[model samples]
Target: MKQFWIVGLGLLPLVAGCSLFETNPVPPSPALTGVSAQDAAWKDQIKRVRGAEEARFEPLVEAREAVSAALAQQGVNDYDAASLEEAQQALDAAESGWAEVANKRRPNGDKLAAIATDAHRATRLAEIARYAAVREINLEKLVAVNDQLETREQSQPTRQARPVTGDARDLVGQKVVPDQLGEVSFQPGTARMKPASQEIVRQLAGLLERYPSVGVAVFGHTDNVGPSAASLERFVKANPKLEQQAPSQAEKVRAFNLALSAARARTVAQLLVDNGVPARRIGARGFGDTRPVASNDTQAGRQANRRIEAVIVPGPDSPEAQRARAENAGS
Candidate 1:
């Protein structure tokens, strides 16, 4: 027993020495410790993204953020792998554009334009993946509902073909609104629809077609950025009767944002109309930056704030529908 204790005590110093040696291994040579090209490129990208955000390069920052948000979404990769892959490809293209621009320290206007175009494409593709994922999730819920109905029908004969009334109707309506609408990006400072936004419009149209009774209230919102003079002039021209009550620059900016948001909402509504959704069942409005789902302090939050959301109204009795009716009557 004494020998065993002595041996254990002797081994303690050996274990301590091994740990010390492991923790203090000789540092690699400077050449060997250098980052690989790939690693350096990745670091450059990180810096670029941060710099873009700081410089308020909306297109590049938004593209980077959108792709990241889409990829991070739950089940996005699994449910919409094709769109997700396309998004990645577009992002890669954007990254390549950045790298090309980096080589030309003073990129010309054309090269800068090309980079912006690539970034916009990346943002659109990422939005497509995100919207597709949301649609897939909604479709799965609908399929589950169908399965539940089938099970009930098999258990009882009378409950079959009951027209999806009551709770089921509410469930479908609730699930139909793509909650990720806040991530649906648009062209910078324009009502023009991105390719991915078109997908969202088509999906909304299909839902309206499938459930004729379901009405949608489309609401547009904007970030806190004040409108340009040209935009404010356009707004004032279009909304002569709804002119600003106060002449404060802030108030005018608010009015401009409201009008711009409304125009964007109308653009989406027009797309729905073209897609065969009845105009009567659709009510479009704008809240400007009033109802932000996220902070407007950061680029990511601002992107989220600048969005168009669609609220599904199940029936005439719904408060949303009633409010729409009231607004129309007043107008």
Candidate 2:
């Protein structure tokens, strides 16, 4: 036991010495450690480049989120692979841009500084370019998905004969008047329609009875108060909170306003369904502040913007209507 202890103690110094030597190994590149001043300058240059890259990438992330949301609207749930590929391409391009600046090592300090700045900007621009390209690709994919959905819908079985006098025939064509169905509201931030919206729903049912083939799309809109993605998230969250450290009165008011706007559309759709509007005939879609009918810069404008519009169209007999119905049924 004593000999074993002695042996272990003797080995400790060797292990420590090896670790010390490994840590202080000579750097291979002159660019790594030739001159302290040059090394510091190079580090500063790299820092600038990284800072610029971060700045550029931050907006790219936002763009990616926007594209992702658009994709989701078209029914895509995962885009990680595409996003990663885009980020890699951006990094590659940025690196190439940096290489060009690195190769032109000027003796003039001012020129070197300008070159570094330019390289940093170039890297940032590259990231932005990559994001733009990826967004375009995502948009194309979304369109393709929409097309597929349309095609699938078109292939659905249709009624062999159109009813000449029944409920089906009456709804073939009708216009949806917004004023007739008044004041729709829903539970704050929920898709469920409120009792107050029942009158409008009954009106919708009457319209359906009048024109059996007419289908209505319940479109929900909201005021533009925050980032589009954030607005959507908030709409989905179904809760209100302070925008920052402390709840500002203004922020609270805005949150309530937005919540009400979101609720209105949901309420309208639910009421329509409750009042005997066929679930298939009624399409519920939330725009979440994207398509604003009125300017959201003012209170009046926000009020006007936060509305539910029921766009009426030809029912199952119409090519588009039939296709959509079929797709929904199959889905």
Superposition-based RMSD of candidate 1 using all C-alpha atoms, in angstroms: 26.3
TM-score, every prediction? 0.42, 0.36
Residue-by-residue lDDT tens digits, candidate 2, 80-144: 33443453454445444444554343334444434444333433333333333333343333224
Q: Which ten residues in a row have the lowest lDDT in candidate 2?
A: 12-21
Candidate 1: tens digits of C-alpha lDDT, residues 1-331: 2232222222111111111012122232122233454333333333334445222334567788988988887678886677668767877876777666564434554555565667776777676676555434533433344335335535774532222235424523332334533234578777887897788788778767766755555668898887678877676667666564545667777777787787888888788878987555565566787766578899999887888766554333334334544664585
Output the TM-score of candidate 1: 0.42
Off by over 4 Å in 2: 1-180, 186-196, 225-264, 317-331
At residue 139, candidate 1 shows an lDDT of 32
Q: Total clashes, candidate 2? A: 8
